[model samples]
Target: MNKYATCPISTNRINERVARLNGLFTFLLIMLFIITRLWYIPAFLAFDFLMRSINLSKFSPLAYLSKGIVKLLQLKKKFINAGPKIFAARIGLLVSSAIFIFSLIGFNITAIVLASVLALFSFLETAFGFCVACEMYPYLNRFLNRLQ
Candidate 1:
């Protein structure tokens, strides 16, 4: 469990405070989607997650917003391995994409449930620094390795 705290899959490091802020933004966006039932909210999140997942952080609006907020708050940097956060972004992309597709096809219930779960995950990340996706990564990595 402790090993996951410093994920070694990527050598890059990122500011943990900024990552938490990004999670907060994600949580708020999902809550907004839940309240407004606007399909584009999830769609935008999916696109943003896609950008981050692909290492194009410069293109992610959430990243930019998070960075700005951190700067405004004068938060001290706390660096951590980027691997877990990158993996979490990929999971976010998949979940948001599913929410978008489900909402588009009239499966409102499914979309809402998924959105709720995603919101909870994001909340945990923001409030508790607990990343469910990061915990799942080692098992997933081992599974993928075995398939090779």
Candidate 2:
């Protein structure tokens, strides 16, 4: 048994503002991909993956931008469980990577569909505080466990 599984880190470690900002950033980038089908979005996606891997997403460029938006708008912090949001970020990373690969390989329709899905998820998180990836995490874990 993994000791960490029994004694996981506290979930309330990140601010809600960060998650919202992340969603907002994701939404914008995905929309850009939908419109341009270019490299910028994919490059940012790669960067996001790298930062998350290093546990430095809090210091990411969009994070700073989001913080600025919060300050500029005088938004209040609404802290919540960090675990789900982190999971959602991982999902975002995966989708973005796929979008990048598909777009690069000339699979425009597939990339567009994936980007649309990602944008929808981001919009939900940004506007409604709902995270599809977060909601799916538990079920996915259980399913994987059963399959093993």
Candidate 3:
């Protein structure tokens, strides 16, 4: 058993890491087409993995990582209250990665332009701790409440 596994991730620190990684992976998923057709499997598997990883930092991140396969097999809908919103920027990352890869292969005429834009955004996020994806959760939740 690794260290990060057994620990219960109820703390704010764990939550923060989960949010950040979720954001990063979501970014990876957006570019699935070029990354590989099978990327969805990894993407969804990653979803399950993150859902389980909610407790990772408490115990062992490695142990939580190993369970992705099991979680995928069980397949449940433990939806995140604003998970998708918290991870919105990740979608942007994936989209940008796809375009970046595409641009490398000379597909879209504006691949360079698109890549540059996304890269710039990513840089800002990394450098200044500006997370566009996570910032919308409160507003999104409010909007959802209004819908109710």
The model with the greatest TM-score is 1
Q: In model 2, what are the clashing residue pairs, if there are any?
A: none
lDDT of 3 by residue, 1-148 (tens): 2322322222232233333444344334434432443434333534443433343322433224423533555643333333433254344535455664555566654554554454444444445545554554456556676999
Model 3 misplacement above 4 A: 1-11, 14-33, 57-127
User: Candidate 1 has which clashing residue pairs, if any?
Assistant: none
User: What value of lDDT does candidate 3 attain over all alpha carbons?
Assistant: 0.42
lDDT at 89 for candidate 3? 33
Ranking of all candidate structures by their lDDT, best first? 1, 2, 3
Highest lDDT scorer = 1
Q: What is the lDDT of candidate 2?
A: 0.77
Count of backbone clashes for each model?
Answer: 0, 0, 12
lDDT (tens digit, per residue) of candidate 1 on 6-115 = 45478888999989999999999999999988999999999999999988998999999999999999999999988889999999999999999999999999999999
Q: Is candidate 1 or candidate 3 better by TM-score?
A: 1
Q: Which regions of candidate 1 are displaced past 4 Å? A: 1-8, 146-148
Alpha-carbon TM-score of each model against the true structure: 0.92, 0.86, 0.34
Candidate 2 colliding pairs, count: 0
lDDT of 2 by residue, 1-148 (tens): 3322422234356778867887888888889879888956866876775575456876578777787888899888777766666667677778888888888889999989999999999999899988788767667776777999
